[model samples]
Target: MSRPPSNTHDLTFYNGHWYVPSPPIVAVLMMPLAYLVGGKNISTADFSMFFSASNAVLVFLILNKLVDRQWIKLPRKSILWLVLLFAFGTPHLWVGISGRFWFVSQILTVTFLALSVFASFKSWSPWIVGFFIGLSVSARPNGLMSWPFVFAIAMQVMREDGQTIDLKKMFAWSFKSAIPILIAVLSLLWYNHARFDNYFDFGYVTIDGDPVVVQNAKTHGLFSTYYIPYNLRVMFLYLPEIHPDGPWPFLPSGAGMNIFLTTPALIYLVRRYEGRWWILGAWAAVFFNFALLIMYHNTGKDQFGYRYILDALTPLTVLLAVSLGKKIPWHFILFVVLSIIINLYGANWFMNG
Candidate 1:
């Protein structure tokens, strides 16, 4: 164990021990499977199937919840269409296909976020929803921002079912929900202290990697506004490259693509959506995640179509479903199809290009 490994990219050496700079939740989840499969025999690609399967099933459950709770809502055709769209039309598909360490973590992060959202809508125990929230944040610290949306949905759904959220019950539920999140936070703090002798430093600036990235992290420090312009450019403005020599008309750059360009169906979000109080919390969650992502030291490396958007995808999809209601409009179908086609290329690029 004391012998050093050859590859040190993103690995840190401190006090005669080595550590990797990543959240360990998803890796920990995979350890049992790895052991059973004789670890070395398992291909990395197989690990990502966990996310691809989870995303498809979670989309079905989230959409079906509307009908399960009350009204005999959308037809089978519409539900199937949405499942296809969600599985193909967003970063979810490509990220799972990639299965790089960062991308795999995103897979689990998005999965837990969807589970947390579903628990809120299903009006499961507030404790369960909070547990999922803890799981998400443990996967990626940014996921902590989504707890507001989950809590609001839980309270509002209970009220809709005519269960009173009296002050006593509210306090009790809040306390219960907060427990898991508190535990997750404390665990992370302990991990950081063990690794770096600090409660706050997750060691991004100290991580070893590509020279350009190292310089940027060292120059501006992590989470500086100085990094916002490049991040915004990649996340929103960068488009398909018009290549002069390549046979393909447009080349997919490693730089991320515009969010709306990738998923045009989201344009409908500009229209008047239903006036649900809890949706404010969902939108708040999206904005909060976006603000932190854009200010981070790096946009992303070797990505297609703004992978960071996965952080807010659950709340955004919840808002979009409410906005569209039961009817599948012609324009909505057109946009979703376009979004799927775009992501088809993204998935191809991620796997083979």
Candidate 2:
């Protein structure tokens, strides 16, 4: 009993055909690179490194844009630190270098998330925003939650400029805004239908010989009340035990540690945000992912610090920057430094392991 054409990351094999459970945009983008490098012999680790490094640069650019627009005023040093921490102080570094299909897909989604956030601040056209968001969804289904946040920001900007949304204008704008998103969605549907003969099947639940997946499908489904506890542990409370006999003094791998352990700066997000409208929009986006992931079957398995939460990093970073109190809290700085060190160790461990 075997499945043919054996790269099992996102693809599902059924009825003598190959199908990708996730949307195909990422694969489409990689096709050219794969072709150029002689597909059979290319190294995914190399592409993963490229995508990760590129995302770091993109975040640097986005921070620069924010400072230039005076969206959030801070010293240049602070901006640099924020960028560095985001790049190295989270799972992005590890996942980017891991070079697996799952990690690469996340890298793609984060790129679009960065673009969409930048577009929102720059007051770019809804078409541009929709285009990026559509790409985000095509990269990862969880990315669909970003649309409302982007649209809300657009609406807030209009209100500040003394423009209101009336019935006619709202309907016209909604239709215009939906065009690109509709195209992406329809394209994905067509792709799925062609592969699996069903428009709605992503094949996640039907993964071959996965006991957890089978149980999840038959019992509580992909998302349900049963998943919250495991998610809570991985997202908030799970800690690696001291294993002096192991490779490093802690558990080398399996499940994941809490977010606070990996990136302490994100703890800032836990506090109440009494700030601008965009801050709320960002929080809303994070909450949407929080709720969704809380019920998901996997905790972004075999990773460091809950890789699933990577989708929320854009909003989380926004919240982190906005919530920084004046005077550059030294304790916070120490916490962030510790976070960077921890993640660096974890990333190295993950890459080698």
Best by lDDT: 1
* Residue 133, model 1, lDDT: 84
Q: Candidate 1, residues 8-78: lDDT per residue as tens digits?
A: 77777766777877778977887887889877776556677677778778868877875565332566457
List per-candidate RMSD values in Å.
2.2, 2.6
lDDT of 2 by residue, 1-353 (tens): 34576565445677776565777776788889788877776677787788788777777777676566556666556866777778888988788888777788899899887887777667788788888888988888788776666766666666666787677755655576678888888888887778778887677766653567556766887788798998898888898778888787876346767888789887776677665666677878988989999998777767878898789887777667767744347777787788889889898778675
Shift of residue 38 alpha carbon in model 1, Å: 1.8
| Residue pairs whose backbone atoms clash in candidate 1 | none
Pairs in steric clash, model 2:
none
Least well predicted 10-residue stretch by lDDT in candidate 1? 67-76
TM-score for each predicted model, relative to the true structure: 0.92, 0.90
Error of 1 at 64 (Å): 1.3
Each candidate's lDDT (Cα)?
Answer: 0.80, 0.76
